[model samples]
Target chain A: MTFNRRNFLGVAIAGTAALSAPRVLGQAKPHVVIVGGGAGGATAARYIAKDSDGAIDVTLIEPTRKYYTCFFSNLYIGGFRDFASIGHTYGGLASDYGVNVVHDWVIGVDRDAMTVTTAAGHSFGYDRLIVAPGIDFVEGSVPGWSTAAQNKMPHSWKAGSQTQLLKAQIEAMPEGGTYCMVAPPNPFRCPPGPYERVSMVAHVLKASNPTAKILIVDPKEKFSKQALFEEGWNKHYAGMIERVGPDFGGANVSVNPDAMEVDIDGTVEKVDVCNVIPAQKAGHIAHAMGLTNDSGFCPIDPATMQSQVDENIHVLGDATIAGDMPKSGFSANSQAKVAAMAVRGALTDSRVFPAKYSNTCWSLIDTEDGIKVGASYQATDEKIAKVDGFISQTGEDAALRKATFEESLGWYAGITADMFG
Target chain B: MRERVFFALALALGGAGEGAADGHAEAIGDAERGAEIWVYCSGCHQIGPDAEIGIGPPLTGIFGRRAASVEGFPYSKSMSRMGSDGLTWTLTTLDAYIENPLVLVSGTRMSFEGLEDPTERADLLAFLREYSDKPSNIPEAAPTARPDYPKLSEETLALVGDEAYGEYLSSECTTCHQRDGSDQGIPSITLWPEKDFVVAMHAYKQKLRPHPVMQMMASRLSDEEIAALAAYFGSLSN
Candidate 1:
């Protein structure tokens, strides 16, 4: 079938009834209901259905028809990839994999009843459940800034419209204007994501508004790939990007989105554009499901990605407190596969391999300049521990960096196929 | 534990004859363990047919082949010179080279810190021997390859696949692959642009991709069935 955005949306809308009708009749097949069809949920849904060969019924509950990946959304902001390329739909998941793709918000999950209640007033029973709702920002973490002021100070962290808004704001910055960013606290989605955003914002500002200054008010003393990002910023966008860490009052920051002003410690500075990424927790659904612990993220068995709270329910993606692995799209995708394998083993009695996970997060510092950090992981009794790892050393040659960048493109292609297909 | 003790006995027996005789028997490694060790090599090098040139050269048929001998691969000057100096990749040479490539030939470009464990090196050698097309003489104690998937023959390629029939078989595939030839994580199999669809399918069938579900699915299909699916998907254009 020819799949495009319009036709896909049409199919999703048309097929919703047919998809849900069968399950409501109480089919004998073991049903796997997945929430939030992003990296983790989509992958788990596809894998379970595809591997089971129609033996298991799979239903993916995602509110949005089109998912904009947070992985390369930074590149979209940097003008490397267009906005459309990052957006994906559930057409393939429904049509190709025999998955029931329901476009609805899951309001509640009753673990005891083994049912998920959607906002559309429908309840779907599942033998197994996967919750991969990604992340939700902590309200009031950035004083005076809330979801209402998102337009004035966008946090393109979730992708979609916010990403577009942030891109436009960067492009619309006045010459020599300051673009201040309030970086999130620790244990946020994509440790290097905020820094990568800074690089992307700098890339746009450098080309369009050369004199524009980019200031990052970061809560942490150091971040993922700190040295590499710093080196890139110094070499490429010299004097344009400046990062203030906690020791320098970066932690004591408040943004008045209404006034377009930022207060760092006691000093107040008015900015042209404010990108505030507040502290984050597991997507609200996990909390609602009572899956989250004190850390505000769900804990899972490293071997299976099954929630500690509920063995029948597996939690994946940025929502899970995966040890040693950073909260990145690559990590989520890797975790999903492990969970899928475990699910398949439990349901279909398939041969289960030892849980081996790997992730490589590639960041484009500038055009053709890419850096990466990756490690192979093995699940022990306690957590997923890193085996051996590699990182792009500072002062890598342009050719190698370009090759690394190109490698990331292949990964993006490969991983997306792995998830969506 | 039994295997380790046997390995230790083999090493003890060979200690006196180390320099006088070829240590092929001493280096007889367990191919099963080698498969595990090969995971480290997989990050850069690939083995088996249809394996593309990646960060490192494909290691298929590497046994007995000269160092830096693979056509189209750009070997470092040091490696090329070593090959030119008649450095063949026999079990002994392979063992030494894999243990310490830089030490074996100074200035070689292979950046892996050498496999320090002797048993691991031996096992990797045993695994490589099983895959090499024109394998060198195997030692008596060398382990055999895992009997998972059969190697493809010329007849398998000659078998014609019905594209129309393949279209019926492709619903499972198109779920992840975009009609426009875009890819997500599964890779764009449309147009057969990257590789021969049959060869790629065979790779999955042989569990070369190491994805268990893909292996299981591929294992269930006949050669003709795979060909038909490949024919349909391969005929697609971007």
Candidate 2:
């Protein structure tokens, strides 16, 4: 039978009554359908399933069975970790946490009927839905660069093949060649990502191709950890890296992956490799569901991570306009906990706690040298406001830097375990 | 005990000092909420003017007291040792010990599992502060001087890790320090009492030990998270 509105309302009403009744054997459990099993969705699915202990059914839909986290993909390029180490399978979430892991791309969301349609012709009904489809690049944000040209000028922003391809291209660059990066504008995932990638590439080239030059054509006037990155570049890779900010016409940039040329305003320069990170918007599913606003991202209630557009729908991670929080995996994981608690409280008679968020982004500049920026946040009426923060200083001792790097490794292990289990 | 309580209230002298002006004097906690939480402690101890010790010593004024300062009290040997070792109860020490008594003093006989909720701890401390030595006339005086605790740990937040025991083990030194060791300078303290070791860790966790690495390692640990580490290392010699 078709999952039309009339049929949905009938089942939804019955499901609502079932939720209020004492849960026992043979009772219909409230189902929570989640789209995009990245940091946010996977963590939420795990939390709800594990915490509820079978009171709520969790279905996580994604296109990939082996999820590659974007957070540590840059480190994979830097050779700090193997590609497989960053790629995690949903076996644990499935076997251990009892999450129904569905490997399918979500095609559409019937908001009126409260159902999600998948590309495989399956429809999932939900008592609540969490949309955590990370981000999608705007069609024409970067002139002369598109997903079709992605192979030639790999935008390894998303992990997996693109990441491997970008790493390979950087390694294969001719000795003394140039590596050019067109950084994205504000409100992008992982604010320090592009710079960290540049560092990783330079770390590779500095060893293999010593005289290779790295150029950053950044649209923003300043970037995250600008001071720390600059100091590290000057000290470690002196005269090896150059960045052109908006003042130097960095904003007006175009790339030709075929010709291997980058035009900055009017001047054109031939480069060996170009990594184009274009402006991004909420995933197509969010837009398709009419959840995103004019900013191309979904605005959420700071207290619950619930989409302001729809009460039954929640948004997480890079797709959200999280106030005062950078779009990082840590942020997404933090937001996921809040959304999970809210979802459980609404569906079941669970205890609802006040919302708290915290995030830390660790960027490695060179071997054994890592810098971190982090802040703890509290949900206020306006938004998630920053309470306290700490950043690694420019002149930190070598021992401290090594310790910070070690701490980051611990965090990666902790978060992935938190997500998958 | 009176000295420590007075010291915390000392910061409140001059009624509204520069500390309060600069917003350093935030409320210690809500005593009303704290009173509700005191039920967990009331089984072993008592507070207020007519209070008396039951299973544990009377905690009428515990803040400034040494580990085993109460007169005629048959405190645990470890706590008595800690008292002699100069383990005074300031606000920081009180907060840490109340969060997890076993973590602060491994041999303490107080069988109450700690208050893991930091807000509840703060509120309980607020209620206990009522029974602490305070001048009732100074209405706006700082309740109890909490020397700059991290706001995140208090703002009704919690991070629940599954391998809490494993993470607790990470903060402990026995993973590196040996059951048998006395190399050049490292002593063969495998025979050392668990109470001494727990007291040393309390110093490190409280930033009293003042080493960078140890502080970082201990700061993130929750109450029950460290129980396994203490149980494993505390009895190593046995």
Best prediction by DockQ:
1
Which residue pairs clash within candidate 1?
A414-B185, A415-B185, A416-B184, A416-B185, A417-B184, A417-B185, A417-B186, A418-B185, A418-B186, A421-B176
Chain B TM-score, all predictions listed = 0.47, 0.55
lDDT of 1 by residue, B1-238 (tens): 3443344334333332442255443346655567667767777787666667888999877877877788898987646645643456766567656765643454567888778677787777766666665333543433343221225667887887877556545543443345565532234456663225675567556644333334545665679878888777767762
Give the C-alpha miss distance for residue A329 in model 1, angstroms: 1.1
Model 2's alpha-carbon lDDT is 0.74
Q: Give the per-residue lDDT of model 1 (tens digit) for A1-421.
A: 0114344334333433345432444344667899999888988888788878898889999999899999899999999999999999989989999999999999987665577889999888776789999999999899989999999999988999999999998888888999999999989998889888899988998888999999999989889998999999999999998888999999999988778999999899999999999999999999999999999999999999999998878999899989888888877877887788777777665656567666678899999898888766778878888875667789876755775686578677766777887
Q: Per-residue lDDT for A188 in model 2? A: 95
**Model 2: how large is the Cα RMSD against the reference?**
14.4
lDDT of 2 by residue, A358-418 (tens): 7778899998788888776778888888876667778876755665675567667667777
- Runs in model 2 lying further than 4 Å from the true structure: A1-11, A14-27, B1-238
How many residue pairs collide in each prediction?
A: 10, 2
What DockQ, between 0 and 1, does each candidate earn? Answer: 0.04, 0.03
Considering only N, C-alpha and C atoms within 3 Å, which residue pairs clash in candidate 2? Answer: B1-B64, B1-B65
